[model samples]
Target: MHPPGADTVLVRHGDLNTKSNTVKRYMEGLLAENLEAILADRSVPGEVERRWSRPLVHTTEDAVEDATAAAADTFGVVSASPCLTTSTEKDRILEVLAETARARYDGGSFAVDARRADKSLPYDSDDLAREGGAAIWEAVADEFEPEVDLDDPDLTFGVEVREDVAFVYLEKRAGPGGLPLGAQEPVIAMVSGGIDSPVAAYEAMKRGSPIVPVYVDLGPFGGIDHEARAMETVRVLSGYAPNFDMEVYRVPGGETISVLVEEMEEGRMLSMRRFFYRAAEVLAERVDAHGIVTGEAVGQKSSQTVQNLGVTSRATRLPIHRPLLTRDKADIVEQAREIGTFTESTIDAGCNRVAPDRAETNARLEPLLAAEPDDLFERAEEAARNAKLVEP
Candidate 1:
């Protein structure tokens, strides 16, 4: 068994920022108070390396072993191993092969999985695979003992080097990298036919919280056809969250919205959204959902403005989850793409189609609340009561 406090790092292919963020969120959710201690005074700093897309970061095998141990204690960590990635510096590709050999012979048997994004890498994938195999054999030499087998090793070394950093990590640790679990027991998401909401749902699911997707269909804005498209979008979302169930909340908001608009100004549209959230809260309680989720990204739109989100949030007594609240638009899109919801989200159009140009961002709560008519609250309650829930 590997000694305690072994420093192991994870090297995954693709975007480093996402991997880092995912790790941080998972750690925070799982470790809770301990996470603050881990980050505030990261005794395991050098234990985790960010090398673009590559799996291995240390130039020496000893360093890899040390990092592996420290990573194991980062909290919420099940297993920790080091990985080395190489998408750049095609010339040094053989070195990665050599390092893998060193790691294997040092202890476990390992296998190599190939990903060739940079066609210009010194050797084509097949050539590299063969060369890597040869290098492993050469490094092991006659020192190979009966106890260690080349073909079936315990460790699975991975390499993904994209852009500038050549990330290196062993397969032992794997990833605590999924969306967080149990931050909120259950929540609702105002999943529209858009990228943000799907990403939001995904984040909530990562937290291990059950999600109830609610879509509002302002018929004239986009009727049953749009509603059907939203349902199709749910089908796509299901792929990422196979174990989770999605419930579609369909609201025929045309008549209600028109009446609300005539009585209240454009700013009141946000208040109207709050009513919908309250409706979701009621449904959530019915289904034993502990909280609500929404695709509200900070500074993404008028309704997503701090004030608007706050106002809408007040309608719900349960916790409201905003997974995308602090993320950038580009980052959110990338996550949507990765989760396979990008294509479907882009195809669905909803209320934003006819949304007023001047949607408020930094709205003052007192003013907006004071401006809302009393009947508006009654209408919201009624609409929420009359809302329909579809299960998929």
Candidate 2:
């Protein structure tokens, strides 16, 4: 527990606990730092400390809600609870439990969900639950008949006893469960003004990879409004990792699209994808990123077919991570909504102006390679060199 009268938020780790001790310690340190960064960014007065593998955020009563919300949004946290803490003495524990229940419960079925993290305590989890439930019932019995419904209670008070302290909380805010940001090397994410690509970048962020967003500006094909939407989507993503000042790399891609349009008709989409991948590779090299992330899903578009995806992947040696590779469109849209990018992505970004009437779904490697401009790699390099940074 933190200082008396201060609010304490208990943050539960997600997959971080599954790692080996060394790795877990490293990740836990990163998580705490990230949480501190979040609090600082929000101007919330707080201090974060690791307690028995969980991060505990201590803040003044005025900032507790904001602190709890920040903890819930942070990556690697499965859940966060703003709790009332007291000494682990049996009488004090029951007193605080009853007080919390009285404030939250109003004439409804209730349950005491207690857990003992400190084995040294004389009472077990069941004993605490039973005693706490009795106290709560007695405190509220005068107002209304207190019914104990263990399976589905109208209000459930959670009690967690650890070492010398007990915490009682009413609600658990769900977090985006995954590894902490910066746990893995950054990825050059090929984001666009569409729904799926932004979601893909978010998924990459969720997977512990801080992202350097690369938006290809198809001058005539995708208008200035398209670039605006893409940048806006990136801005929304920036909210996720407030500690990092994310910049969007704007790669000029009109020349490459024009070249594809002039040289190849049927495989234009495939060749264009190859150009995007190559451009990403150049950016990845410059930024020392480990991989490239995209929104391509199997059979989602002509260029995203299994065979065509393979054909396009040959353009870059770095790994291509398509987070939405197997996800359905509906699910992707739902996630976009959840992450606060759906509306901006829905705004009209003109369709690909160079798309052929019928793109080759099952493109082969050799012929597609042959159709590509001899200076394709050079063009990609040029695009990467000329990329303008857009701060979000």
> Whose TM-score is greatest here?
2
lDDT assessment of candidate 1: 0.59
Model 1 lDDT tens row, 223-329: 76766766766876554344345667665567666655666666666876776677677667667877778887777787877777877777768888787889999
Off by over 4 Å in 1: 1-176, 179-184
TM-score of 1: 0.57
* RMSD, candidate 2, Å: 2.3
Error of model 2, residue 81, in angstroms:
0.3
Q: Which ten residues in a row have the lowest lDDT in candidate 2?
A: 1-10
TM-scores for every candidate against the unseen true structure: 0.57, 0.95
Candidate lDDT values, in order: 0.59, 0.86
